[model samples]
Target chain A: MPTIRDIARLAGVSVATVSRIINHSGKVRPETEKKVKQIIQETHYQPNQVARTLYQKRSKMIGIVVPNLNNTFYAQVIDGIQSVLQKNNYSALISFSTSSDGSKYLEAIDNFKNNNVDGIITSAFTPPANWNPTTPLVMYDSADIQDKIVRISSDNSKGGQESVKLIAKNVKKVLVQHWPLSLPTIRERVEAILKELNRQNIAYVLEEVSESDPYLAAQQALNKRNTFDAIITVNDPYAAEIIKEAKRRGVNIPKDFQLVGYDNNILCEYTDPTLSTIDQQPHLIGQTAATRLFKMMAGDTSTNNDIINVIPIKRNSTY
Target chain B: MPTIRDIARLAGVSVATVSRIINHSGKVRPETEKKVKQIIQETHYQPNQVARTLYQKRSKMIGIVVPNLNNTFYAQVIDGIQSVLQKNNYSALISFSTSSDGSKYLEAIDNFKNNNVDGIITSAFTPPANWNPTTPLVMYDSADIQDKIVRISSDNSKGGQESVKLIAKNVKKVLVQHWPLSLPTIRERVEAILKELNRQNIAYVLEEVSESDPYLAAQQALNKRNTFDAIITVNDPYAAEIIKEAKRRGVNIPKDFQLVGYDNNILCEYTDPTLSTIDQQPHLIGQTAATRLFKMMAGDTSTNNDIINVIPIKRNSTY
Candidate 1:
């Protein structure tokens, strides 16, 4: 119940000094800061965050909007974002955009604006045509937006190219499973794979599957009786589903067929035959996005052309 | 940049009426509410949330603290909590307590108090001996806290009992892998399993493993050369790891050894031979905690003794 004025009076410091110590906005001597903190703790004086936010015009909070948290990739990305945010003395308000149409994303953005978050980082959701945001927006992995917004993502095209190069010589025919090509990230991966496969004169089949249940799509693909010698999946979970279903049908991995997955999540290592995967290093991607957002907030206009590189991790999945 | 006074003038309403409409705290007629919204939209008026918070003395925000989000079970629980919180018109400020010592949890609680959250929901971190909280707190999946704090958890004991019942008739010896037994939830499950196994006079071994890397623990357990006919894991990921390792060692599941996992996560169905596990229904647990928090926030003092039931799911792992 103690006010800032009371704290200042008790600590024998100016109100601005107390505010500086509380907000960590301006530099203060270590001794003075320690003493002020001690007094504040002793008094149990809770500063009103609303008033502080109004005065500083910074909430010290960031909004993170992802399509789904149930997916380990997204969860790991969030974990990376939080790691950086916590170190920088910021908190994250996370929301899910379960639909591809981006309605939930719009709602999340509106909520961020309403709460006056200092910045926002979103993954895989494009803003509507009529939507214009006043807050600084950083798009993660969906880089096809307007030039004003900052985009940080891994090199999906390069990952796709590498995946094909690693397995192209070993297989006669390959099945490339992916999500909808409407998403720019997915499109880039598919395009790169096709370009590489065509250059090699290798026969391949491309299948677009629903993001929610790639297992069912894998099932349908198997039932089609395609004579593919290998499978390339857009992500690790899809690769896992394919592996499980193939095992159910008595298909021998690395002997009868080879498989590769993207995102290089934990599932890739835990699966039998130890799945070969493209490591996007999602934690690094998240950290990069947070650092970029902070730089943008500080009025740095330097263009960031950095794309986190991907590496192909070869395990027991392919010969 | 438009002020509330300007909004009131344009909407033909008093400043207090405009405030009421903005806060959604008081009743406003349908026509007046519609007109006020129109004017507000036309002006692009962004309310100062800090000022609004000061006036209302409520932030309409909740805090959720969990140990980790990379685990799918925690992610699912958070998804459920967000579902309920969003429906109730509240935003969640989520934080993680990475360490088992409970320091991060205390910090999160302090942050929640400083931010004036209406309530808090936390999982599996005990407060320090000297710590006291003034905010309404709900402990999720950790029920061994003080008597004053409301604890909401699934019947982990019953889950352990059911897991044993499902696999008891088929196996001669069992290996139970879990995290530290000091945790209330883990203790409950282990105790229930042991009690049931003793009642049935079935021999079993208990092993505590590092949670961060259950795969390594599974490897170590397999390397110990224990001649066990079945394995009971505290969660699904560990079960998956054991299955992967067992298969690597040419150990066939349900044929060589039966397995039962807890939490019945999506991984259970995706693994080869499909893991039989206990279903804790994490979504319902989250929903129940949120409902209880809301009841407590409304000054309800009645004790809640409801325990969500756990079900045993049969799959190829347990025959």
Candidate 2:
């Protein structure tokens, strides 16, 4: 590894100057730092991490608080953000708070802050509106924060509307599958879906089950046999369970009953009739979230903290 | 947070000795270090991270390399390990390498090494026979590295057998979705599956797809419209694609064909038939990998690095 001294010599600067530039130490002329950086890049010199940590006095880490890593949606988003962060040499401290309450989320965030994380990406429920961390913060799909913090999410309303419209076109009586409206985002989706069905004059049953909890959702859905012509799920996995149980009862999708799910997760494409699902462009959402976080950390204060919505992707589930 | 003085008083050590122990300085005796750690635990005194970094010159960061983060099998495994790492102060540098070639894998490993990462978690193709690292290492789904490293994986042979039996019961003609046996693990699975099928007096077609890509495998299978009755995919996502395409062509599952997938990924559940899939227990495997890495780092030199087989879980896709 080329030491700072080697780069300093190559750039005609003292080792002290090189260190100053690398650590963003006070008052090195911008032109001089640029020249040093040029030489460092050319030499493929990766600063010795051990020495840099000592000088920077900060862990170049982003504290990422996700609700459920087992959930496919959050998992994909984390993968996306991690991909970008890896390129920037920033490590992610990922914490999965599968707990229903916000206590673990708060603890994870507080702990990460104590660890001197450079920034934080967390769910909205974890931190109070008045809460402020030493580092930068961003929220993913949180409505409670409103316009207070950077928020990234897909168009849940549009997704719900589209799924409703799909069901309206194909089936007469449909059962909208869902978990309890635990999050405001899910509630918004449920509302939008109902509104769309009303607008279309499509007769539907609002089957409110604990769809997010896989075991309960499957068991509950199984208990209700032959009630509707189709079922629309809040998310893809829940849709999977409904379809499986429906099949066990000899219910045929798009034949005896149509099935549609939201979030065209990888699983959506694999279902027997290939579930028609409303898409949130999960990968793009990930890319957008990371880029937005980077921009905020880079001192973009004017960014509207209001929900930034991603467009829905229509797939086989609708048709 | 409590300062070193408080810890020193608690441990009956001098202020300077406490500093050395908490900062990971070599001058402090091991016994003193242990005492300091205990005090830290009892008090829950998370030191100023900035101060800790200044003295230790280490960030306690680790790196993880997965073949594809989008793949649920790997994603679940990552979730399991990340659950533990997040609790500790270790941040993870996550990366995905497309090629299974050891060079791409090595590139990621070297990145972690150069970053002064405390350890590594790699979903390796085939781990090196005597791979040793200055930092701790954990290998997932890799085998035959002697007792020098940690390895975690599902029983591919058993997964294969379970899949075949599941498919055979429903469909007389089954298609084994796979690529050429370049890897011994893949070869073992293929052989075990054929052996089981032969014993069952089943007539199966070995549909060898040249590409290991999921979409390609699905497309190739789709092209053979009536070539098979039941489709067994190499992985969950691959099985998903077959189901999607088969449905697009109006082929009803269980009516026209039976479908089974491996990796019992969330995709299996979301699929229309709720995918009869072989669950590889990725979560348990991931936890094991992290635990083993800790052991290896703590100077455990006698871990069995042979293939650690986890049982496959059966889900809805089968009969």
Candidate 3:
């Protein structure tokens, strides 16, 4: 309940000194800061964030739009964002917009704008054609938008190329399973893989899989007439299901068929053959996005879009 | 930049009617409401949330304190909470405080209070002794707190008892690997297991493992003794590691040693033998907590603390 004036009076310092200490803007003597802090703590003085936001037109809050929290990848990315946001004395308002219809995504954006967030970080949701937002928007993994919006993503194309190069060594025929290519990020990886395979003249079969029911997709892929000496999956979960189903059908990994997956999730290390995967470094992607958003908010216009490189982790799944 | 007065004047209504319609507080004529809404949309009217918060002393924001985001259980719970919060037009401010020392927990509490969150839902972190918060506090998976604090937890004791009873059916000598029982939830499970084991007169040995490194604990547990016919793990990740390590050592599960794990995560089905675990229903826990918090905020004093039921999932490891 104690205001800045009360803290100043109690600490025997000017109100300007109190404001400086609270905002860390203007310079104040170390002794004066210490005294003001002690008084503020003793009196349990909480700065009125509502009033401050009204006066400065800044909420010190950032909005994060994640597709799904059940995915460890997104959760870890959020963790990375929070780590940076906490250090900078900012709060993150998280909203889950899992629908690809763009309605929920637009609603979340509108809600953030209504709350007057300083910035927004969204993962893998393309805006509608008629939508336009004035807020500083940072897209994470949802690329190919307008040039004005800042985009941050892992180098999925490179990851795809490296995966093909790795699998091309031992197998003549490879099965590549992917989700819908409607997502620009997934399309980038798919195109890169196809280009590399064509350049290498490797024989490969591409199959589309449902992201929701990857296990069924794996089963359907296996039931197809074409036999593959090796398999590459869009993500770890699909690869895991393939490995399990393949084992059920008496096919051995590495000996009969090699396997590779993207998104080096923890399951990659625990799978039967210990999956080989491309590590996209989701945490790093999140941290980079937050850092770039902060820089942009701080009037650093030179902060350009970034693409984090992915690393190929080889385990027993592949030679 | 259109104010409430502008929208009201354009719609031929008073400012108070616009405010009531916006806040959904008081009754307004249907025709007037529709006209005001149309004009507000046309003019792109966004109410100043900061000003409204200052005036009404309510932000319609709830804070969630999670210890770790990498864990899928917590992520699923958060998803459930967000689903409800979004439906109610409330925002979730999430904070991660991984330390058990309680400093980060207290800091998150302080930050949430400063931001004027209507309530807080924390996952398994005990509040500092000297701390007293008047805001509605909900403890998720943390029981035995103050009388006023609402606690929402799965019936860990029941889950533990069921696990022990199941394992005792096939094996006499059992090994139980758990995290530090210092956590109230873990303690409940451990105590229940021990009590049941005693009642059945089944010999058992208990070992504490690091939650961060379950694989090492599994290896150490395996190295410590090689005679147990059954093993009970604290969670799925530890069970997955134990299964993988046991396979490495040429130990067959179910044929040689039965295994049971807690928190039936998604990885449970992907494990080689497929893990048998206690399903804590994290989604229901989250939903229940949010529902109770909303009720409490609505001045429902009779909202009692709840204990969600846990079910034992039968899988290859146990059967």
Off by over 4 Å in 3: A4-21, A25-42, A128-132, A144-146, B5-17, B26-39, B129-131, B144-146
lDDT of 1 by residue, B1-319 (tens): 8999999999889988999998888999999999999999999998865567777887778889988887777887888888888788888888888886777788888887767778999886766665556888788886534466678778888988999987886678888888888788888888999999999989988888887887797787688635888888878888888888888898788888888888888777777778899888888888888888888888987555447888899998986
Estimate, for each residue in A228-248, the C-alpha lDDT of model 1 and write its tens digit: 888888788888887887788
lDDT of 2 by residue, B1-319 (tens): 6877788898998877877766666687677788888998998876765455546655566688888765667777887887777667565666677678887787778766655667788886654666566577877876343465566655777877887877776567788878677765677778889888888888888877756577778888878858678877677777777777767788777667777777766565566656777766788788778777767666777657645564555555566
The TM-scores of all predictions, comma-separated, are 0.92, 0.79, 0.93
Rank candidates by DockQ, best first. Answer: 3, 1, 2
* Candidate 1 local lDDT, residue B306: 48
Better of 2 and 3 by DockQ: 3
Task: Tell me which of candidates 1 and 3 scores higher on lDDT.
Answer: 3
Candidate 1's C-alpha runs over 4 A off are A8-17, A24-41, A128-132, A144-146, A303-305, B9-14, B26-38, B129-132, B144-146, B224-226
- Candidate 3, residue B311: Cα displacement in angstroms equals 0.6
Model 2 / residue A59 / CA error / Å: 4.3
**Alpha carbon lDDT of residue A10, candidate 2?**
91
Q: 1 or 3: which has the higher TM-score?
A: 3
Residue pairs with clashing backbones, model 2? A179-A211, A270-B240, A271-B271, A271-B272, A272-B272, A276-A316, A276-A317, B275-B317, B276-B317, B276-B318
Minimum summed lDDT over a 10-residue window in model 3 chain A is located at: A141-150
The residue pairs in collision within model 3 are: none
